[model samples]
Target: MKLSEVISIVDGALITANADLDMDISSACGADLMSDVLTHARSGAVLLTGLTNPQVVRTAEMAEIVAIVFVRGKRPPLETILLAEEKGIPLVTTKSTMFKACGCLFQAGMNSCDV
Candidate 1:
């Protein structure tokens, strides 16, 4: 699914890269540890996490993640959002827990390699 499609399906807001709503999201990776994300996330993947630190954005950038979904009602810091804007990374906040968010997207046809 495309990034915009995921946002539409999950009711996610664009925290950054509003212009990049059309970017492709071929997969997803859910983890709280930035290290795991950096090691395993594929290109153009959406990262789901509850960590709200700037390091999360940095890890996503390094791994080339397509988008980020903050679960459990978490939100990244303003500086992190600004950096994401500069890097053109799409970020979203959801009330759903990490497991539910990932499950919802998966049930809606997203996958770790679903496409």
Candidate 2:
């Protein structure tokens, strides 16, 4: 699925203005634990999480995630956003809980990175 479609699926707002909205994301991983994300998330996957810190951005970068969706209407700090922007990762915020957001994306045909 495209990043734009993911945004629509989760009813999220894209906070990364300069990032590519048309990026193709084949899978997603929803986790708040950076360690779990690092262990299981696939490259080019979208990371859905409630944690909004520089560490999350760093983890996404290290994992080569395509984008990030901050669940429960949570927004990252300016420093984190700046880091994401510098890394060229799209950032989104949704009012849905982590489970709901993941479900919506799954219903829209995006698979989980559960290999």
Candidate 3:
């Protein structure tokens, strides 16, 4: 799936200054634990998480996550946003909960990062 499609499916808005909206996403993973993300998320997957910490951005960078979707309409602090922007990782936010957003993407044919 494409990042644009994920945005449309979850009613998400890009929070980053610039991002490749056309980036191809290999899969999706919804997790709050950064360790879980590091362990299970595949490269090119979009991470659906509620964590708005700068550490989330760092974790994404380490895991090679293509993008991040902050659920429940939560917005990260400016520091987090800046880190994401600096790292060239796109950040998105949605009013939907993590479960709903993940379900929406799954229903739309996006595969899970789970093996």
Candidate 4:
């Protein structure tokens, strides 16, 4: 699915400038634990999480995640945003809970990375 489609599916707002909204995301993984993300996430996947810290961006970078969706209306700090921008990762935010955000994406034909 495209990043634009994911944003529409979860009713999210893109917070990053110069993001390629047309980028295709092949999989997704929702986790608050950076360890779990590193363990299970796939390259070019979208990470949905409630954690809003620089570590999240760093973990996404290491895991090759294409984008991040901060759930429950959470917003990352400026430092985190800057890091993500530098890494060329798109950042989105939604009011949905982690489960709902994941479900929304899944229902829209986005498979879990583990699948």
Candidate 5:
């Protein structure tokens, strides 16, 4: 699915400046643990997480995640946002819980990252 479509499906708002709105998101991974993200998330997947730390951005960079959706309306701090901007990773926030957001994306035909 396209980034724009994923955002729409999850009712997310983009918070980063350098996003490719049309970028293709090959899969989704919902996890709060950075270790799980690094271990299970596939490249080009959009990470749906509740973490608002700068470390989340760093992990996304290392894992080659296309974007991050902060669940439960959680927004990252300025430092985290800046790091994501620096890495060219888009950041989004949604009012849905992690489970709900993941479910919405799954229902919309977005595949989950293979475990």
Candidate 6:
């Protein structure tokens, strides 16, 4: 689904990017642990997390994840945004809790980021 559709699905706000709405996502993974993200996440997936640190950006970069949806109204620090900006990753925020956000996405036909 398009990023715009995802935002609409979860009532998310575009934080760092006016990303292209045509972006297609095949899967998703929600986690606060960067290690799990590193080990489990795959390409063309959106990451959902409450963590707001630069490490999140780094993990996304390494995992080649280009989009992030922050759960529970969490927002990353400016430093994290700076890194994400440099990496060209999209960041979005939502008021919904992690569970609800993931569920909404899943119901919308988004799959797990893990293989």
Backbone clashes per model, in order? 0, 0, 0, 0, 0, 1
Model 5, stretches more than 4 Å misplaced?
none
Q: Measured by TM-score, how close is model 4 to the native structure?
A: 0.97
lDDT of 5 by residue, 43-114 (tens): 999999999999999999999998999999998999999999999999999999999999999999999899
Candidate 6 structure quality by residue, lDDT tens digits, 65-98: 8799999998889999888888888899999999
Tell me each candidate's TM-score: 0.91, 0.98, 0.98, 0.97, 0.98, 0.94
Candidate 5 global lDDT: 0.95
Each model's lDDT: 0.83, 0.94, 0.95, 0.94, 0.95, 0.88
Candidate 1 deviant stretches above 4 angstroms: 113-115
Q: Candidate 3 residues 1-115, lDDT tens each?
A: 8899999999999989879889999999999999999999999999999999999999999999989999999999999999999999999999999999999999999999987
Error of 1 at 52 (Å): 1.1
Give the CA lDDT, 0 to 100, for residue 39 in model 3: 98
Model 1 scores what on Cα lDDT? 0.83
Residue range 1-115, candidate 4, lDDT tens digits: 9999999999999998999989999999999999999998999999999999999999999999999999999988999999999999999999999999999888888988874
Q: Which pairs of residues collide in candidate 6?
A: 28-113
Off by over 4 Å in 3: none
Q: What lDDT does candidate 3 reach at residue 5?
A: 91
Candidate 2 per-residue lDDT, tens place, 34-54, comes to 999999999999999999999
Give the range where candidate 4 is weakest over 10 consecutive residues by summed lDDT: 106-115
Give one digit per residue, the lDDT tens place, for model 1 in 29-97.
899989888788899899989998888889999999978899887778898899888888878988888
TM-score, candidate 1, is 0.91
